[model samples]
Target: MDKHGNSYDKALDVFEKLLDEPLQKVLSGPLPLARAVGLATTSGYRAAAIAESEGLLSRSTEGDYLRGPSTRTIGLSALGFGEFALVAEPVLIQLRQATRLTAFLAVAGNSQCMIGPHSRGRGLTFAVPQAQYYLPSLPVLDDERLAEISLSNRHEAVAAQRAAIAAVSEREDRQCIVGVLLPGLHEAATDDLRAHLRKASDLLRTQSEKLT
Candidate 1:
């Protein structure tokens, strides 16, 4: 019997003996012993019987089986994979404050892009408030400068997002890379937006380092 009160030691000994034999020879050799043990109503008695039959346990003159030092098989439960949110809430708030422009957060999950909390500028004359829009497709950008600004300002976040993006790129359901962006900003404020995003990214990076 094992520490768990199961006769796994005998079962292991029988299994090891069976493993030494070739697959084709198993049926004619120790396989019958294993099958009998597996079908036994009492697992412990079955294991002992298999061990004795397989010559793993010695039989005494009185016909009693003597146990031997052997390994055992222990059952294990499956482990769960926990979910984690990489970007912190403070980072989003900082990005909003720094840019004074609309800021968005996103993550890649289940072959789709999930947009998280977002903030918009209070004084903006144009542009709609798109807080939690799940864009099944990638963002359509008419201005190359704005795209560059977004990438540059959210460098670290973008890097993590790109890694996730690369994982799902081959799949048909895969969405665009994860990152933050400002929608419907003015063409004239592209440079300023870029500057603010850079500042926000830098601040976030600094805060992250301190936490480490």
Candidate 2:
């Protein structure tokens, strides 16, 4: 079985793209492997296999793959309905509304930061994934600029991402990052947000110990 939940986001994207076709047809019959693959134009065989082993799909006696329990589980989880998301989304929303900035919640997984629930500020053009994870050159927690929320207004680098504080969540328990982008932050903040973002990594740890 595929133990790691890597590529789940991409695989799910492929799944959603194909849902209107084969998945609809398969409601009455077993979906052919090739047909399933054909529908997933962006996904590879390996990704399909991973989705299968993860319970997103199941091979029938005839070798056809069918939707399984994990599909719904993963879907709900992706939509921020899972235990971790449910607990974390509120905090993320609160932070965003409070700051009127882009607020995001990400969890640490596989040595990478797994993006989770998020809120967007007005005029925010970019988006972060709740499915994919980013492996920065250095850990978000290791950064020097954390715990100082006010610094973001100055250099935009130190105060911007503040990876140091977010890294705390990744320590012994729920390794998650909660970021709030200031209204004045510019496009450069994108790199900071993507490359080194932080906040509430410690809060997640304190609030949700079960997340680990």
Candidate 3:
């Protein structure tokens, strides 16, 4: 590849790292561009300048970096998952209304869950600091458990949180975890939460299939 080609490839890598980093930290404050892009200061700054010129990144007042407006536009654009969000938003709203709890959709990893679109409930609520979390209660990911609903609980700051998660296939190579966040863990409330989650998951799965 030519020199220009090399620069282009490095710029692409920077964008990938920008997306891969925890969104909460990205939004919270400035991040070290050199370390984030895995390049030396001079090279990383050069790559960042290229990305900034195209609106893929923005520099903080303190000279750190974060995702720019263009990134959100692309994320919600058709090229991303905007269509799925359109179909899922109504279901999420309904789930929130029915259960009076926060209803959310996330991309689940082995032990972490990346929070996505969500409907917040009234009163005291539990939300992720950075919209991504490592919930110890979340079931481990496995081929056999990919499409099954899992229920679990974890305590945070004296309040017990209960979650009902249903992992379903989103695409041939992707899957999503649809879930609800409740304030407390109560045996009496588990049944209702499970029922609502099951219904919502079914709607999401059915709607997701049509998109593919």
Candidate 4:
């Protein structure tokens, strides 16, 4: 532990690594006791007991451990980026799982995109640093990049690149754009790619709309 008593922070890190489901859903999966014992100095049971007592983890009615109430709310208020990430997390996760690619939610600001929550697919994935303020503009080749940049700042992107589809959520807080990676989507004509991307983008828009 740090001199400032950051044990809770460490515990929070471990708990996040254990999650395999959306925070809004009840976790039906159970993590083995070994998962905690491997990290904490204490015994597995002791670690689990302490985590549960502190509300960092919850014990289900079936006696299995899952995400506690505190886990989802941990950093919701920490920063603007964090709040946006938390709100968009469930969508990004489901998108990655469904499409098998890297998924991210970002906001379009003056000539750039603000990165929010993101997830990786089964195939090779790339990452951007947290301090990155602008989004990377992937080149348009074959099934490579989505989102066409226009002179007016209208951001249009492909859902295939976005994986399970992504949309710009309609909200006053910020104009957010979502993107997903499309693996194995190669060697297609540009027109065909645009068609596919348009469909995917529409789907993502619909899904995000439902959430709002």
- Which candidate gets the maximum lDDT versus the true structure? 3
- The global C-alpha lDDT for each of the candidates, from Candidate 1 onward, is 0.37, 0.47, 0.60, 0.47
**Tens digits of lDDT, candidate 2, 1-212:** 35355567655656664333434455332334435445443334555566666766665575655565565446436543344443555666665555556666555445344444466665553333334434433343334434323222222334333322244333443444566544442323444443333434444555555653
Per-residue alpha-carbon lDDT of model 3 for 1-212, expressed as tens digits?
Answer: 99999989976777687655534355332236557556777776676677777777776686556565566446545223444565666888898888777888776544445566677776665344236565544454444232333332333433234556666544333347767765655423366677787788778778866876
Candidate 2 has its poorest 10 consecutive residues by lDDT at 147-156
Better of 2 and 3 by TM-score: 3
Candidate 1 colliding pairs? none
Poorest lDDT segment (10 consecutive residues) of candidate 3 = 144-153
Candidate 4 lDDT over 1-212, as tens digits, reads 57556877766665565443323344333345434334543444565666677766777577666655455445322322334433455666665565555666655544445444566556465532231243344223224335543211224443223222233443444445556544434422245434544554455566645554
TM-score per candidate: 0.32, 0.39, 0.50, 0.39
Which residue pairs in candidate 4 collide? 147-156, 147-157, 161-180, 161-181, 162-179, 162-180, 163-180
Evaluated at residue 56, the lDDT of candidate 3 is 73
Q: What is the lDDT of residue 167 in candidate 4?
A: 39
Put down candidate 1 lDDT per residue, 33-75, tens digits, no spaces: 3453353435545654666565445444654333321211110
- Candidate 1 Cα misplacement greater than 4 A, ranges: 1-91, 108-111, 125-189
Most accurate candidate by TM-score: 3
C-alpha RMSD for every candidate = 22.4, 11.9, 8.3, 9.5
